[model samples]
Target: MSATAPTETQDLAPVRTESLAELLIATERPPRPSALSACLTFGWRAMLKIKHVPEQLFDVTAFPIMMVLMYTYLFGGALAGSPQEYIQYLLPGILVMSVVMITMYTGVSVNTDIEKGVFDRFRTLPIWRPSTMVGYLLGDALRYAIASVVILTVGLIMGFRPDGGLLGVVGGIAVLLVFSFAFSWIWTMFGLLLRTEKSVMGVSMMVIFPLTFLSDIFVKPETMPGWLQAFVNNNPITHVSSAVRALMDGTSPTTELMWTLGWVVLLVGVFGPVTMRLYNRK
Candidate 1:
């Protein structure tokens, strides 16, 4: 008679359930997917999206073509020595610009996800939280890398080969990529802050345009007024420009890249935590 009652109580004990806060507080770092494997997987997925929706490729592909034509043919001769010379100078700027500009996608896509409740679904997954942004950033960088390759290929065809040899060219590109990746945290904050994709675009434009133009992207900073020149000279983007130019020219500068790397370190230092905080609040 007691066996039936004993079966009910003795058979099982209630499992403890963790509160969300408890789970989060006790959470360990998610196991890392191999960086190389993750990169390839994420990169291919992103590129596949571009392949399926040809329109999405516009930012990387179409933008460069228009930028090259608009800057080179339209303003190159007036701005630089000649169209050809401008192409040589402008191509590097354009390459850097293209990658830097693509960082806007971070916020825009994040904003889109927030607006569409995509992130609501994302939170339910067991993966590393930062992996979402990490994947997006790396994938987008891959997109930018592909775009840079395309731009350089076209530039080579259009007589814009780098004076720098293979190693120098690779180093220059590497710096550009690192700079892009570091600056992405700023836009990631923007993306997490805003809820709409369009707002992301608007805010990004406001910040990016002034920074890009204020740098020596098209014109040398020396040509600016003394007051503006001082600011422009000190701008991190200018350091990047100087470094890229030096790299392309094969002139090993004593401290040019140090400055560029310093900017990257500074940006990561400031924006990285800010982005993480903003994301947490979201």
Candidate 2:
């Protein structure tokens, strides 16, 4: 058999190929979400978390009631002479403390996500990162609102009345929500700095406890020693508490309101940039 010379295989034309990056850019990507959409998306996400883990709402739910009851009764007698009388002063101040206590949850939540690498995934997403953050913080609006309503309702049952009427209560809540929202950015920075969620919780409590108790939240700053009064007078939480008290009482809040708002602006301007920077570096 004549060994037929092996016919050289004809060279086939090179197949067209798309780089992975190009393929992803062309086909796999969806439109990036708008700022409002991103915010609403994360806001719903946070709400859903509460739904799934209903215990997550304890801070807004049973805790506030318990705190209102405990503080109003415990300190009311010693501080204001009667629980009924105490509720007037106590309500607004307790509202401030309740929200501040709950504000740490934002840091804890963000820290949990960071530990789970959820934030890493977020970085790769097309959504506005800041919107996600703002939305997450905004979601806390409902929590703050819930705590406000519950506290006020219980206060009513317990004989707490506001001379400022319904409008004043609403305005007080508005002020608290704005200040708390701005304050959450401070925790956001802590979330970025701390390694563990628990650490964030502990550190937040450490800062929050002294700040809330030592301020005018439960008692008059004048009752404190002159030395302590100096710090209490300057404490930003004191300004917020005074503002809330004045707002609820429908008094002129110019001085305290100015200071409270100044704190809000300062916290947001300073910690906001620092949180973003640390997040990006990570």
Candidate 3:
């Protein structure tokens, strides 16, 4: 009998089923988290990682100390006439260098995450795509802050002083953090474009070392050859170092600070898009 002629209610049951299916889908979908919240959550993840693996902090801790000592003693007498004199100039420059060098670790970490298929899990989640990178960028700022403190504390122990007072020191620290976050996009690009973490680390060092060492970090750029001096004068790191130096010394950092901030805009503007493109492709 049913085969012969199903009632209208029976015939429409499939439609009702389809409607409920759509309803289920509509209700089951979760709301997206705000971009800022997502970033902070991910930033928290990074901070927790530091807690579990305290050794992850070795670079920020040990490197800054080594650099402060090595540069202070190795070149102090010849360059600034004494370790004490050099520490003032050297500390600021080294603060910038320390933060810059540590930025590479972000790239390596990204690559490692990708290699392990961790990001595949991230993609399946409903969050802002850029948030992960932003999270890393923000979280690394904490690391940068740690490094800055390490450097400054070590410097103070070694008879270094910041004439800019606590305010200058605080201001310089803030700038270093902003600069580190901006510069990290370059390493993020490296992480995305490269296949392995080791390669990212290698390329990062190759680029970062020359920029840090060849600039006015440890000595006067005028002592460099004319050709070298020209490049050093234009180097973005040179501006960062100059700004940090001025800020820490209580001098007006307007000109150098402006230049350094400009570089921050440029780096983020250029690398930000490239990083996202490569990130999506990955």
Arrange candidates by TM-score, highest first: which order? 3, 2, 1
TM-score of each model, paired residue for residue? 0.81, 0.89, 0.90
Predicted structure 3: clash tally: 0
CA-lDDT, candidates in order: 0.77, 0.89, 0.90
- Candidate number with greatest lDDT: 3
Alpha-carbon deviation at 109 in model 3, angstroms: 0.6
Give lDDT tens digits, candidate 1, residues 143-236. 7777777778778777887778777778888888888888887888888877678888998999888878888888877789999998888887
| Per-residue alpha-carbon lDDT of candidate 2 for residues 1-282, written as tens digits (9 for 90 to 100) | 888888789887765556555765775557778999998989999888888888877888798899999999998999889999998998899999999889998988888899898999988888876876787798888889998899889999999888888988888899999999999998888988999988999999999999898899888988889999999999988999998898888898999989999999999999998988888887
Could you tell me how far off, in angstroms, the CA of residue 17 lies in candidate 2 after the best superposition?
A: 6.2
- Angstrom error of the Cα, residue 276, model 3: value is 0.6
lDDT: worst 10-residue window of model 1: 1-10
| lDDT tens per residue, model 3, 71-168 | 89999999889999989888999999989999999998889889999888988888998999998888888899999999999999999878899999
Choose the strongest candidate by TM-score. Answer: 3
